[model samples]
Target: MNTNTTIKDIQIISLPRIEDRRGNLSVIEKEVLPYEMKRVYYLYDVPGGAERGGHSHIDQQEFLIALSGSFEVVLNDGEQETTVSLNIPNKGLLIPKGIWRELKNFSSGAVCLVIASDVYLEEDYIRDFDHFIKSKNS
Candidate 1:
């Protein structure tokens, strides 16, 4: 796995939106993302001032989008950290492997959509912050 990745590698991708008189349309293709999406999931009904996603993946990449309300994604690479707000439907955040991420400051009725590069695997997750930092140095 590539453990050399940093917070600098994370990016906010803008999807193509077609506006119309009735409604708007947004599109996402496999070629536009850095990795092919294999799993898709979403988080909803989160209470206000709650948090989620306090772990790092070993070999999986992810893209996070706010489908409804707004939230904040805090990313840390064991050295530096940054926070990004997700409130737009056409915007998504790309998170590479080997970085620690925490989702917080969710508004009421916030819906967070996530796209993963790989399927669910418990072994691929670094749930502990100390272990994640140790793995980054090793």
Candidate 2:
């Protein structure tokens, strides 16, 4: 884990929006993200007041967008914490490594789209908060 990482490293990235008579379209090309995207996934059907994501990544970085409805992401960087809301399709939250994140307050029909820098690797995740803090401080 990166010990120097903080909440300020998180960024709000805006995708290019092309408007047309029919509807607006957003694009995510190679230059959009800091790293090359290797995997993509989405989360949906979360019951009201239910929460997701209680872990911090050791190496993987992720970009999360609210494709539908809305949700709040609570981020902690061992010394400080903040909450960000995602309710737009063309905007995304870019989360770097070594920060703990929790997704909550999901409205009905909310869909969270995640674009990741790496594939699913269980060894890359630090799931416990105490262990996460220890790793960050060490």
TM-score winner: 2
The sequence of per-residue lDDT tens digits that candidate 2 reaches over residues 1-138 is 646889999999999999999999999997999999999999999998789999999999999999999999999999999999999999999999999999999999999999999999999999999999999988
Model 2, stretches more than 4 Å misplaced?
Answer: none
TM-score of each: 0.97, 0.98
lDDT of 1 by residue, 22-78 (tens): 989999899878898999999999887778999999999999999999999999998
Question: Candidate 2, residue 50: CA error in Å?
Answer: 0.9
Instruction: Report how far off residue 110 is in candidate 2 (Å).
Output: 0.6
Output the worst ten-in-a-row residue range by lDDT, candidate 2.
1-10
Candidate No. with top lDDT: 2
TM-score: model 1 vs. ground truth: 0.97
